[model samples]
Target: MTTSRTYEDLVKEAVDASVDGWDFSWFEGRATEERPPWGYARSMAERLAVASAALDVQTGGGEVLASAPSLPPLTAATEGWPPNVAKATALLHPRGAVVVASPEDASLPFAEGAFDLVTSRHPVRTYWPEIARVLRPGGTYFSQQVGPASAVEVVEYFLGPQPPEVRDARDPERARARAEEAGLEVTGLQEARLRMEFHDIGAVVHFLRKVIWMVPDFTVDRYEPQLRSLHARIESEGPFVAYSTRFLIEARKPGR
Candidate 1:
């Protein structure tokens, strides 16, 4: 990587860039992250091929669901963000899937036991009970979630060291417990820690901007000092490295 580019140029480009939808195409050359081995999209598509009715929760731009080569006869997806709702609708409607405008925290808009398959990818938050409620007996719920301490390297660099509870808020075990409590049987669960790299400060900026929850109040003005220092470090050190944790979980509703 070259260090000749000024920090001002990189950060401004990222800051002004659009972060709409779930697409991360803008970071093609600026950053990179190792993908999990489970091949979440392929796996979800395989299950979708066999399902009779399916619903995708927190379907950000319907990207993952839209990637499926086949969908059940009755397919639908829910997204809370208006921009994402529009994006998802535009993508999924042509494929015979209805996109619903629903908040992540609100109850699912469908009737009970309406879907035989439920899927989500990197949801802001998983509503276990709601998922179970919408799933039919013997239905399956599959999701790829951000695991505990995901991308904490960047969090710590931007802010500071976080408490144990805050860092472990998204633990897989907690998710397992919640699913069990919701009357679902855990079928499979796996976790992975993958390498992440930022070639420049702009990638970091664009990342934080896209994934707002990572740093709730991330603004270049507020973190300019830290950004400048990190940018310098990257210029000298080649690229900044971080590890992001992810988990794949599958659970089933028990019944005949």
Candidate 2:
């Protein structure tokens, strides 16, 4: 007869697993998330094909950039976390990309107008001035960013309701304004709300571990009561439901 694992067993498994890179393969069957319709990777790849020099900021493990079918002559990626920096270096070096270890919130290290194109996927925080500084005149900045109130359902489930300010932290309009302030014109902007489901408590644990910004200081011991309650809910319900908000933004520096 088959045996079902206990909630503790599942949570422990997730906690012990390595979340080294940006890879989410471990959640294959345990969780599901709907992707945006624009196909960000494909769009970025198309832009990459035509650019002569490009930079990918906050590149976690270089997974997205490395996946491009072709890279520009001079391609570089910046990573904040050390583990991810090493991981990205390993993954991108062979592909003719340089991985720079940069501070999470520090100014970018490149010289002024160094790249013809700049891209980022879900950057922790957008540095509009820095982006403009690093891009040549007429250069484009393309990115898919986390929108306001993204995955708040899961967040509130663990931490209770949050203030409006916290909920609207990543507003797309604010991003547009910032880009404009930095002398870049916003050419395209689109937002989407996608579905997310967690089939088991372990999936939740893994997600929290990987995406540290979700809970900030999430811990199994500290939130055991809430975790247990959520475990019971998942046991009864088919799956826990949440929504992920994403926004695609394209900005350009003036002058051809």
Task: State the local distance difference test value for candidate 2.
Answer: 0.95
TM-score of each: 0.98, 0.98
Kindly report which residue pairs in candidate 1 clash with one another: none
Candidate 1 lDDT, 1-256, residue by residue in tens: 6666799999899989988788889999889999999999999999999999999999989888999999999999999999999999999999999999999999999999999999999988888999999999999999999999999999998879999998999999999999999999999999999999999999999999999998999999999999999998898888899999999999999996
RMSD of 2: 1.6
Name the 10 consecutive residues with the lowest summed lDDT in model 2. 1-10
- The residue-by-residue lDDT of candidate 2 on 1-256, one tens digit each, is 1117788899999999999888999999899999999999999999999999999999998999999999999999999899999999999999999999999799999999999999999999999999999999999999999999999999999888999999999999999999999999999999999999999899999999999989998999989998888888888877899999999999999988
Clashes of each: 0, 0
Model 1 bad stretches (over 4 Å): none
Worst 10 residues of 1 by lDDT: 1-10
TM-score of candidate 2 on Cα atoms, chains taken together:
0.98
